[model samples]
Target: MKGLVIGGGVAGLRAALDIANAGFDIYLVERDYSIGGRSAQITKSYPDLTNIKDVLKPLMEEVYNHERITLLTNSEVLGLEGEAGNFKVKIEKKPRYVPDGESCEKCIEVCPVEIPNEFNERLDKRKAIFVPFSYAIPDGCVIDETNCLHFKDGSCSRCKEVCDGINFDQKAETIEIDVGSVVVATGFDPFDPNLRPELAYDKYDGVITSLELERILDEDGPTGGKIIINGKEPKSVVFAHCIGSRDKKVENPYCSRICCMYTAKEAYMLREKLPNAEISACYIDMRAFGKGCEEFYEEVQKKQVLYRRGVAAEVYSNGVNLVLRAEDTLLSEPYESAADMIVLAVGVEPKEGSSELAENLGIKMDEYGFFVEKNMYDPVETEKEGIFLAGCCQGPKDITDSILQGGAAAAKAIGLMGRHSN
Candidate 1:
């Protein structure tokens, strides 16, 4: 039996690995130049401050080297035909322009065009020919056609001059594959804080999102792990939680489960980096439900991280620093605080094309647009036979739950394929 897994994040990686280790052929398709997805962007994880790349890079290597698993990066499933135990999937593979087995640095060093690095949340710039991140698996460079000088006007060929790996003539390829089962593991997108103008996300220089802070804390990120804003270390930092989740104005009423814990984790990280700096996290509710989560929250509190029960009403510049006005629900009073940096703990939502993808897969979506599972008890199974789900595509969840669901989805796929053969 053969299986196909869509989306190459942690969830899809685990699902594909499980099926391959069981001696079945599996194809893992990713819509990016490389895998890793949002998890790779995180500097450290909550509950335990394990380095994000330490865990992700090793898994990525295993998947890339696995013989039974076919890694299809820069690809997406265009359409699906047939039913359970017999399926034909059409895929569109985008061109990366970098040749296989060529040194990526050779092309990158010669490329002169610079643009905002999306991987760093636009905190820095990168050459037109570059890898998504330092630890990108398959260890190669990908050309950005949109910004590459050669593609824009056919004027510059410096990258190609130094590297024989450049393939300007590469075109998008269409592929067809046969599989017995399919798993959809496309992850969620971080909520855009600009939707909440009260936070002053893009309007202020010091205002940034929690995801952007993750990159700042990362050693390979924009600032090389320095927590600085406007060329100096911040003396005061304020974290505001539930920027998108549980907010009716944006129409996202569901709780983004990871934000609370991640904000606490960021607070602790700040305490370590800036021991004397004042740190506060404004939150509506402290949902530390995961195992060891409450203990970690207490640890941050001991480090002098103030936990305020409130929501920030507005943020604005005050010449010297940014002023955050919020209501202290516990004290039943208004409070105004000053901070050099304000971090918005934005929530997660379904990826952009989720609705269209659900329709193509012949599945249903909830009111908020997350794929609906076959039944609440069967969280991994989709409404259609032989179709399964894992990770945030089903709903907002943490890394632990996503990995567990990935394994469960793989089990279901294997069992169904076995029964079909019988």
Candidate 2:
């Protein structure tokens, strides 16, 4: 009996690899053009500050090159039927237009259409015919039909003229497969800070989300790893925590679980990059519950990052700098802190369309749209016997916990399939 893994993020990759290594044929389905989900967008991991590329690259390479794993990029599960021991699955694979292993990169220069690069958090523009990143796994250019001129009005064919690999005629197709067990690893999306307009995330040029800052700090990122705001390096930076998490007004009352530590890490990085810049963080409470995370938080404090007990109440421009207004809970005094750049440490939310997917799969989701597990003790198992949950799809978690759950889900899948084979 074969196995199936969905979502193709770090968690999905881990699940597929673990199951495949156990001698099971596994099909890995990823909706995106590339396999490395949101984890690929990150610059570094917290606590250790290890470069994420170093950890993700080798794992992605191993999965792509594995013999027992069939990677289906730009694909989604359409339907599933049958029980734990046997199941039929249908998948829809989208056309990339550009043939695999055949990009000369000349097409990118000739393409007339440009759009916001989502992989870079819209900090830069990319041609309609372009790759998601430098080392995207299925390394080839993908034509975004939504914005491509050729697809819109057939008025432009510059990319096809320059490169023979561009095939506008390629069409999407469907595939059917059989698997004994399924693993859902669909990940989380960062909360939209615009929900809280008081922070002025949409109106200000100086305010950016933490994910955007990750791209800025990346060596291969939009700004080439420079900590620049408004085209100039900021002398002071302020971080506002819990923008979309732990707030009843937004209806997201759960702690995002990673914001505090990540903010601390970012502040530590900022200090390293700009030793003279003043750095401070406005927070409601600090929860360093992870292993070694408390030490890391203390270490960041030693780097001269001022941590104040408060929540950012408002942000307004003073014509010269951005002013953050908040009340220090301990001191019982309201104060305004001025900075050239303000980074909102946004929280994680369930992936959009998660409810639809859960309903289709005959599983249950919480009010917040996270997949509900069989029980608190059996976190990986779903209501359906053969189906399992992994990563942030179950809830907000850090990278380590996501990978851990991925392995746990894989083990459950292996166990069920092993018994069926016997």
RMSD score of candidate 1 (Å): 1.1
Candidate 1 residue pairs in backbone clash: none
| lDDT of each candidate versus the true structure | 0.91, 0.93
Q: Candidate 2, 377: how far from true, in Å?
A: 1.0
Clashes of each: 0, 0
Model 2, 1-422: lDDT tens per residue? 89999988989999999999999999999989898899898888999999999999888999999999999998888888888978898899999998887667999999887789999999999999998898798998999999999999999999989888788999989988999999999999999989999999999989999999999999899999999899999999999999999988888999999999999999999899999999999999999899999999999999999999999999999999999999999999999999999999999999987877886678899988999999999999998999999999999999999999999999999999999999
> Which residue ranges in model 1 land beyond 4 Å of their true spot?
none
Could you tell me which 10 consecutive residues in candidate 2 have the lowest summed lDDT? 353-362
How far does residue 187 in candidate 2 sit from its true spot (Å)?
0.2
The parts of candidate 2 lying over 4 Å away from their true place are none
Q: What is the lDDT of residue 39 in candidate 1?
A: 94
All candidates' TM-scores? 0.98, 0.99
lDDT of 2 at 162: 88
Candidate that would win on TM-score:
2
